[model samples]
Structures are given as structure tokens and as C-alpha cells.
Target: MNQTQLNRMKDGLGFIAALDQSGGSSPKALARYGIKEDSWKDEDEMFDLMHAMRTRMIKSPSFNADRILAAILFEQTMDRTIDGLYTADYLWEKEGIVPILKVDKGLAPLEDGVQLMKPIPDLQKTLDHAKERHIFGTKMRSVIKEANPEGIKKIVDQQFEIGKQIAAAGLVPILEPEVDIRIPDKEKAEELLLKDIEENLKKLPADTKLMFKLSIPTKPGFYSELMKDPHIVRVVALSGGYSREEANQMLSQNSGLIASFSRALSEGLNVAQSEEEFDQTLADSIESIYQASIK
Candidate 1:
């Protein structure tokens, strides 16, 4: 593991940029960027456009280490190049931002009020490649739609089991068991989630550290205890479906948790904008999230 990168992640004052939208989510991301379904002919071209958007975001002046601690990338993005350097290398070498890869295949069908991650076949190979390309860590996600104790426990167990494998491969793992923000019993679900994650943290190996990406809780500071856990490197909040203004407002109420936003971070950016307009929009987004993170 890169100790310096780990330390930065643990103590950094900024937020993580979630640029890892996969095939399932890329169309919506592209559409939001002012590209529609008619623009791309097939899957490959679709992904290429998505990559172009990510590349543009990374190359922007505001997407630097000062207010951006790290970026979570899709596997293809990690494999691609930015200005002649591999994506991960460019992030760390040129911009001083750490790079983390999204390793989950996506989610399984919702069962028992939760959706576990789909199996990641040949995960070891992916981890090995991430290390070779200068990746500092990995992020995987599962979702909880209600307060089912059994389902939440299963999700946490699977995440920690996979997290152990990631740790064994010499990379930190950000285990995201995101509770649905719109669920009727959101607070109950978060309560159950907190218990399950706490139990798993107790069982984790002494040397294995983990990060968490969760929905902003219904109750402010609800995750404060988790932030203090010795085995937890950091606890971050996902924007889930919140608007940038809403997400930032909630994030500022949680003193210790930082942001790891996808759509919210890209909200206002569109392909039609001029280069100057695009950069200014991105800079504004970064600044708002950065201020919320430091609160």
C-alpha cells in the first residue's frame, strides 16, 4: 500500500470525485452532459463518449489536489490515458490526486430489501492491474432499500469478505453499503446498517483498514462513532439522488464525513459549454463541495 496516499486519504480536507459510472449508469451521465442516446452507435462508442467526459473533467484546472483528494475511476478509465500518461498515473503524478478504481460489477436484483453486489469474476487480476497502474485503492457498492436486518448483515459481510481480499492484494477498499435516501424507514435502515458495519469492523484483521461510502444520514452526525473507529480510514457520504445544493447542505451538518459525489459533482456541466464556461462551472462545483467537506 502507498502509505503517503493512505495518510492523505485519512486526513485530507477535500472530497472524492466519483467518475466511475459504468455501462448501466453511463447513459444517464452522458445525457446529463448534453449527449443523448442518438450520439453513440454502440456500447464501445458509448463508453468512449463517457470516457471523453471523464477525461475533460480530470483535465480541468479546478479538478486538482488542493480541493479534490482523489477520484474513483471505472476500470476502462484506469486503463486509458490522459495527456499521454495512464489515468491513475496522471492523477497522482500531475495533479497530486490519488486514484481509486471501482471494482464491483454492479448490483444483484433486490432481495430481502437489499441489493448485494454482483460477483466480480477475476477480481484479483483487476487488483493486480490497479496496483501496476498506480491505483491507491478500490471502491465497491451494495444497496439497502429498507430496514431488513438479515439483508443488511449479508451486505456488510460480503463487503468485508471482499474487502479482505482487496487488502490482501495491497490496496485499501472503500466498502459502500448505501442506504436508500428515499426509503420510508431511512433512519431505521441506517441504525441497522451501523450495527452490521460495527460488527464487521470488529472482525476485520488488525492491519486491514477500510473506508466507507454511505448515504447522508437522516440524523446529522449519526456516523460520528464510525469515524472514530481505529480500523476505519475514513467515512464518506454519497450524494445518492440529492441535488448538489441539497447534498452539500446535508454534508456540512455532518462534521466528520466528506463527500464522494457523482451526479452532484457534474451537475451544471454540459458539452455545449465553451471551455472557459466548463472550467468555471467545474470550479464552482468543486469549491462548494470542498467547503462542505471541511465543515
Candidate 2:
């Protein structure tokens, strides 16, 4: 483990950039970037285009450690390079931003009002590859759509079970059991989710520290206690389908929680923009997110 990276992750003042959109979400992501589905004839081409978009963001002047603490990458992106250096290496060595890999194989069908991550076969193999690529941590996600105790419990349990494995591999894990922001009982779901997380935190070893990527709570400061837990490294909020403005507004109301946004982070960016235009747009987005995070 790189102690310097770990210390930076523990004390970083900026937000995480979720550049981990995978197979299922890539088309939508590209569409928002002004690339249509017809632009690529096959999966390989699709991924190439996606990688290009990521490369552009990574190469941007505003996408460094100054206002971005870390970046969560898709496995394929980790395997690729930016400016001749491996993506994770470029992020850490060149940009000073910690790199985390998204390790989940996407969500399973919604069940019991939640969607747990599908089983990850040979997960250790993936973790090994991430380490070799200079990744500092890993992130996996699950979703909660309703306030069902049984469902939310399952989500947290699966997250921690996998999180422990990530820790044993000498990598920090950002456990994300995101509560759907638009659910009718969103606050109730958050309450139940908090209780389950607290219970799980008690079961971890004393030295095991974890991070969380969650939805911005309906009640401001709802996660204050969780953020203070010794076992918690940081608590970051996902945009969870909210627009950038809305997500930032909700995030600023929470004192310690910071952003780990994907769509919100890439919101004004487009493939057709000139280099200067793209950089300025990205800079504005990062600035807004950074301010919201620090508040």
C-alpha cells in the first residue's frame, strides 16, 4: 500500500470523479457526450470511443488533484493508457489524484426493492490486476429503491462482505449502497440504511477503515454520526440521478459528505467542443463540485 496515497484519501478535501460507467451505461454516457449509438458499429469501437472521452477528461487542466481527490475507473479504462502511461499511473503520478477501480460487474435485477451486485467470479484476480496497475482502492455499488428492511440489510451485508475481501487484498474499498433519491420513502430508506451500516461497522476489525459512496440524504446531516466513526475513512455522496445543480445544493447542506458524481461531473462536456471550450466547461463543473464538497 502507498501510505502517502492512503493519507491523502483519508484527509483529501475534494470530491471523487466517477469515470466508471460500464457496458450497460456507456451508450447513455456517450449520448450525453454527443456520440450516438450508431457512431460505433461494435463493442470494441464503442469502448474505444468511451476511452477517448475519458482521455479527454483526464487530460483536462482542471481534472487534477487540486479539486479532485480521486477517480473511480472502469476495469477496461484501467487496462488502457492516457498519454502513454497506464490510466491509474497517469492519475496518481502525473495528476496527484488517487485512483480507485470499480470492481462490480453491474447490478442484478431489482429484487425485494433493491438491486445487489451480481456475483464477481475470480474477484481476487481483478484485485491483483488493480494493484499491479497502481490503484489505491476499489468501489462497488448496489441500489436501494424502497425502505424494506430485509432488502436494505441484504445490500449492506453484500457490500461489507465484498469490502472485507478488498481490504484483505490490501486495497481500501468504497462501499456504495446508494439509496434512490426519487423514491417516495427516500428518507425512511436512508434511516434504515444508516442503521444497517452502523451495525456492520461494529463488526469490522479495529484497523479496517472503509469509505462510503451514498446518495445525498434527504435530511441534512443524516450521516454525521457515520462520518465520525473510526472505521469510516470518508463519506461521499453520489448524484443518484440528480442534476448537477440539484446534487450540489443537497450536498452543500451536509457538512462532511462530499461528491462522487459521474454524470454531474461530466455535465457540460461534449465531444464536439473545442479544447479551450471543453477545458473551461470542465473547470466550471469542478469548481462547483469542489465548493459543494468543502461546504
Summarize candidate 1's per-residue lDDT along 1-295 as a digit string, tens digits. 8999999999988999999999999999999999999999999999999989999999999999999999999999988998999999999999999999999999999999999999999999999999999899999999999999999999999999999999999999999999999999999999999998888888877888889999999999999998999998999999999999999999999999999999999999999999999999999999999999999
Number of clashes in every candidate structure?
Answer: 0, 0
| Per-residue lDDT over 75-192 for candidate 2, one digit per residue giving the tens place of the 0 to 100 score | 9999999888999999999999999999999899999999999999999999999999999999999999999999999999999999999999999999999998888999999999
lDDT of each: 0.95, 0.94
How well does candidate 1 score on lDDT at residue 276? Answer: 100
State each model's C-alpha RMSD to the native.
Answer: 0.6, 0.7
Q: Report the error of model 2 at residue 213, Å.
A: 0.3
TM-score, model 2 to reference = 0.99
Evaluate candidate 2 by giving its C-alpha RMSD to the native, one decimal. Answer: 0.7
Candidate 2, residue 240: lDDT: 93
